[model samples]
Target: MISIKRFSELSYKEAVVLWNEGFKYYFSNMTMTVDAFIRKLANEGLSPEHSVVAYVDHVAVGFAINGFREMDGKKIAWNGGTGIKPEFRGQGIGKVLIEACLDVYREQGVDLALLEAVAQNERAIALYKKMGYEVFEELVFLQQNGAMTIDAFHTNSNFEIVRGIPEDIQLLEFFQPIKAWQVQVPGCKGAESIIVKKGNEVLAYAVYQRMMDEKHNIQTIALNQCEIKESIDVQKVADFILYHVFQPHHKIKRMVRNLSKNNRLVYNTLLAAGFETLVEQVHMSNRLDQPIKESIQ
Candidate 1:
């Protein structure tokens, strides 16, 4: 018989083992130590009360993790991960795991459920579709190394640039409240933001974090969001923001996390700045206002 248990019902060691076993031989290396697993759960706002482990004959075989937050006054839930052991494949456990997630979300009054799947993972994407999830946006992970050659986008406009903490961006009227969960400002604690202003008017903004070496030499920089005011010359403004935020002289590894493909201005700007697409994912959503279809029902 197959059964499901809450992560709270299992010891931390058991939970870690369940996650490792569920994702064993996965397309990506998801194996994690207890500390790393717990840290990830805590950092992502996933709680044991909402996460579950699948068991068969009293042995764990699958797991799902979920997190919740309120955005724009609506409660939203994000599926951090869902996986089943290799030997347990094609046994309907994946569907069970998803249904369990929906139940948890409903219990928590989630207005919408969100998740992302690798673009190439057709099987997983198909399964999500069957579980009432629909892909609404494509997310791309882009990277640029050393210096960028964006001379064509260079401008002589003199906009005052302000450097502030991540919280500062949240206060902006144009701040995007909903996006990929991992790239949200709350998840990017300690990150910085570069706000470009024309006198008193805020024109554009980018949130980023920089890593330094032992000697404090710059290493990697990840820009979580690069938003520009569309009324202005979007391309030119994005170019200016990119040029300033990713100063060409830095010559460090730079990355943008889960940028939406639908966001043409910023996406095109990154492509023009010599950034390459390193990964692609589909952001999916399932509104909970309607009845969620269950296979067994």
Candidate 2:
């Protein structure tokens, strides 16, 4: 027999083991200690009540992590992670896990459900599509080594690129709406940011978090959000923000992921600046309250 229970019911150590085991061979390493796992859950606003772990004959075998938030007054739920143990693969556990997630979404009044799958993970993508998700956008992860030649030069411009805090992100008039979950407003609250302004008019804004090694040496800087006013020169705005943000930390690794294809200006600018595409993903979404299409049903 199989059973699914709230992830909160599992001990921290138990959940940690399940997490590490479930994603042992995923596209990337997902192993985490109890502390790291708990910290990630807290930092990302993932819900213990909404998340689930599956059991077969009293043994933990699979899990799913979820997050919820209200954006522009619409309730959105994100499936942060869903994984099944190797031994449990080829069974129906994956579908059951998704159904459990939808149950939680409906219970929490989530109108839209969002998730991302590696573009090359056709099996997972097909499963998600069978579960009623439709592809809406393509997200790319761009990364570059700090030691690489960065030609982001300081430009003489009408606008002043000033360092700012996360609190100032809302002041930008042209923030993108359909951004990835982690780069959204709530995530910005925990990040450091910079913005461009001409006199009193805000033109563009960017936010990122710095990662430091044990010796407090700069290691990686992950750009969480970068937005530019379309009326202005895209390359110029990108150069201003990129140069100012990265000039001081030119020797560390810098990464920005989940950048949408819709933002061609910023995406192309990054490529022009020598950043390479590390990975690409398909952003898929579903409406919870609506009925699944007859074909899939």
lDDT of 1 at 183: 83
lDDT values, one for every candidate: 0.84, 0.81
Best by lDDT: 1
Instruction: Give lDDT tens digits, candidate 2, residues 101-131.
Output: 9889988998889899989989989999999
Tens-digit per-residue lDDT, 152-249, candidate 1: 35778777889998778888877776789988887887689899887788888888888889998879989888788766566667878888777766
How much is 116 displaced in model 1, in angstroms? 0.5
* Pairs with steric clashes in candidate 2: none
lDDT of 1: 0.84
Q: How much is the lDDT of residue 242 in candidate 1?
A: 83
